[model samples]
Target: MKAIYLESINAPFVLIEKEKPTAGPGEAVVQVKAAALNHRDVYIQYGRYFTKEYPAILGSDGAGIVTEVGAGVAPDWVSKEVVLDPSTDWGDNPGVHSKEYKVLGMPQEGTFAEYVKVPATNLHEKPAHLSFEQAAALPLAGVTAWRTLFTKCALQPGEKVLITGIGGGVALAALQFAVALGAQVWVTSSSEEKIEKAKALGATGGINYKTENWGKALKADVGGIDVSIDGAAGEGFVQLVKVANPAGRIGMYGGTTGMIGQINPAEIFWKQLNIYGSTMGTNQDFAAMMAFVREKKVTPVVDSTFRLEETEHAMRYMEAGKQFGKIVLRVG
Candidate 1:
């Protein structure tokens, strides 16, 4: 078997031959057909993640066929086409994850190889509508978007939604899911090209965040936003607050820009606004996300594809931030 091996921090992710992984008890070995890149994979190279490991196989999302199943697993699982849920040991609490929780790519071998083993519980039958590459793109970003809107915000139909950084995978998924649920969507981006593309994807309109007072302008143009989803909670997060309708919900998934800075307590209290911090979701959330994608026939936007041998180049492309959607790695 061949896998992308990260030898150390700041090292290249090189393809290396290795013994194929075997299924452990209650686990299954998937023959990966496709895998998707997340910023987390890039963060590992720079040693920027909260957790890190050397000589690692880093990939969080993948689609594949189960070729081997361990003891206690159903025989039916073998040869099943599946998309894996990266979240594990989510514990009993639905509102938040437990200390045992870990994503697939770190501290455990992930989907960057021709064969990877995972707990069978993480496998869900792949959506029939999606190709392997498309299914590979759905897990992490899809669940992140799903938890932000549907779980944290409880988004309602006919309400207005504001998704920041429209070109990224999670943001794109948020926009698509919101639209599919009958919400009117708007987005924020520095790239005019991305904004236009977002509009084509059911967003009503979008504004260039580079423009002065862009937040105020968006509020004026769209009226009040009922739910706003953002991964970058930088200085612009306050602006999301500025644009929200009274009693609106704001879901923050990541802090790419760092620091919440200062927020006006008065605005939050006066409007009765809800600010919810979120991450890649619980098992229940993954189940609901899968069901939603299946029911709505949601297809993830594939920005590009690269062979597993080109994992290094793909990582750089993702780091460049030029991609408008998920960048996938095609595996054997």
Candidate 2:
């Protein structure tokens, strides 16, 4: 088997041949077909959230076939096509990262390999409509968007949502999901090209984060948003807070713009606004999201595909924000 191994922080991934791993009890060995990049991978490479573990396989989202299942695993799992559910819990406990759970690709070996093993519980049936690459793109981003809107905010039809940072996979999924649910969606991106892409994807309108006052522009276009999905948590979160309707919700997920922010407690109090923080969703949420995708014909936005050996270049593309959507690595 060939796999990607990261030796240290900010280092290039090394492609090496290794022995294939077998499944353990209650686990399944996935013959990885495709793996996708996440901003979290960049952070792990930079030693942000994950520790520097040499020879680590760094990827969380993947789609593949179950080649082997260990003892105690259901016999029906054999040869089943599946995608991983990256989140361990739906927030029955507070905090996305704690001692309770760790996302794949960080603390544990990930799917950037010919084969990877995980608990059978993490596997979800892959929709026949999706190719291996597209299936790989959905697990992390799709699950996060699902938890943010459906679980955390309980976003409803006819409401308005402001989704920031248009090009990432999650933002695209959020926009598509909101639109599918009959919500009016507005998007923001620094790139005009990305803004146009968002509009073409059913966004009512969008603002170029490079030039326009997105917050004020959103207010003008939609009056105010019932919910603001802020993937970029820097100055943009403050603006997301600014554009929310009274008693509206702000779903804070990632920190593409950096984590720390200046937030006004008074506005939150006076407006009776609610802030919900979410990450990748629970197993149940993953199932619901997949069902929705299958039913609604929702397609994940895929920017590019690379062979497993090209993992290094894919990481560079994601870090540079050169890709419009998820950059995937076809493993086998």
Candidate 3:
């Protein structure tokens, strides 16, 4: 089996041959078809996120066909196409995994390979409407966006939302989901070119944060927003505070702008705004998101695709902050 192995922090991933893993009890071995990249991968690679053991496999979202089902798994699961959930839990016991917790690809081996073995519960039916590449793109970013909007912020129809950083996978997903829910979407990006891309994705308006003060622009042009979807938690959080309407919510996820930001207490008190922090969602959230994808035909915005062995190039593109959406690796 060919896998991309991270030998050291902040170093390039290497393609290497390793023995294919066998399914353990309650686990299944999948022949991976496609894997998607996220900003979390970059942070993990640079030691800014998950702490890694040597030679870690680095992909968290992927789709594939089930090849083997271990003991205690149902027979019908074998030979079925599936998407990896990435989130996991250990029964009602609290040990290696919590009573309700653990994330695949964080402390365990991940899907940057020809095969991956995970608990049968972590597998989900791939939306019939998606190709392997499309399904691969959905698991992490899609779930995160759904959790942020529908779960955390509870965005309402016809409301205004100011989304930060238009090109990233999560932001792009949030934009489409917001529009589908009938919200008027306002987006921001550092590049004008990227802003145009957001417009193509149904954003009602986009601000080139490079040339414009997004906070002031939102206040003047869009009349302030009802919700602010902020994945980049930098100086921009202050902007979020400025642009939100009274009783508005700021959904914060990533720290693409270096993890720290300022919050004005007076404004927070005056506006009575809510700051919501969301991470990847529950298995139930993933199921509902898939239903939305299937019924609404909402496709993920893929920026580019690469061959499995070309993962290093994909990582480089993500690190350069050049992609307008998810980057995928065509595995198997």
Candidate 4:
């Protein structure tokens, strides 16, 4: 098999000949047709993520075909077109994942190769409306957005939404889902061009967060936000609160900007705000999200696509934070 083997932390992605893996019990081998990059892959490369182990594969989102099924797996799975659910071991609880929960592409081998093995349960039929590249972009970002919005915040059709950092995969997925659900959506981005792109995708309005007091400006301009979504949490997090309407809900999936600074207690308590910390979704969430995608015809935005061998360049592009959607690596 040809694979991008990360020999060590911070090593460049160099495709090399490697042994292809066979499926284990209850597992299946996917011949990767397309895969997508996430910020997690970048952090893992620099030894900045939870696991420092190297000599591993790094990828989270992929769409492909089942080539083989392991012992106890149904033979019928072979030749099925599928997208992988990157989240695993979510356990019985919906409110939180078990201690054993993990997103694919770290300690476990991932989808950055010609063939990758995953639990058969993680295989989902690709949404009929999506291409391999589009399906590859959907799994991780789509489920994260779905759980954060409808599951955590219970966003309603007529409610207003504010999605911070508009251009990234997860943020764009949330924007598309919210728009499809008939919500009035707003967004924030460092790039005016990205803001414009979000508008083209159905966002009602947006603001350049680089401006001083941009959140306050957004609140003033848009009246009040009924729901807010964020990934970067830093001193500026208070701004999300500033723009939120009373009883507004804010769902945060990541803290890329490090620890959040102080927020006014009154704003949270008096307004009865709900702040939820979220991560990857459960099995149930993944199924529900895929159904939503099928019903809504939501397409995962692709900023660009590169050949699988251009892994390093694609990683650099995502790290630059300049893309307006998911970056795909065409495999197979």
Q: How high is the CA lDDT of each candidate model?
A: 0.94, 0.86, 0.85, 0.92
For residues 1-332, write the lDDT of model 4, one tens digit per residue.
88887889889988888888899899999999999999989988898888777788889999999999999999999999999999888888889999888888887888889899999999999988899999999999999999999999999999999999899988999999999999999999988899999999999999988889888899889899999999998966999999999999999998878889888899999999999998889999999999999999898999999988999999998998889899999997
Model 3: CA > 4 A from native: 90-100, 259-262
> How should the candidates be ordered by TM-score, best one leading?
1, 4, 2, 3
Superior by lDDT: candidate 2 or candidate 4: 4
Q: TM-score of predicted model 3? A: 0.93
- Which model is ahead, 3 or 4, in terms of lDDT? 4
* lDDT string, candidate 1, 1-332, tens digits: 99999999999999999999888889999999999999999988889888887879999999999999999999999889999999888889899898988999898988999998999999999999999999999999999999999999999999999999999999999999999999999999999999999989899999888888677998888888999999999888889888989999999999989888688898899999999999999889999999999999999999999999999999999999999999999999
Ranking by lDDT: 1, 4, 2, 3
Which stretch of 10 consecutive residues in model 4 shows the poorest summed lDDT?
A: 47-56
TM of each candidate vs. truth:
0.98, 0.94, 0.93, 0.98
Off by over 4 Å in 4: none
Q: Report the C-alpha lDDT of model 3 over 214-254, residue by residue, as the tens digit.
A: 68877889888998888888777888898889999999877
Q: What is the C-alpha local distance difference test score of candidate 2? A: 0.86
RMSD of 4: 1.1
RMSD (CA, Å), each prediction: 0.9, 1.9, 2.7, 1.1
Deviation of model 3 at 97, angstroms? 11
Which residue runs of candidate 2 sit more than 4 Å off their true CA positions?
Answer: 89-98, 259-264
Of 1 and 2, the candidate ranking higher by TM-score: 1
What is the Å distance of residue 260 in model 3 from its true position?
4.8
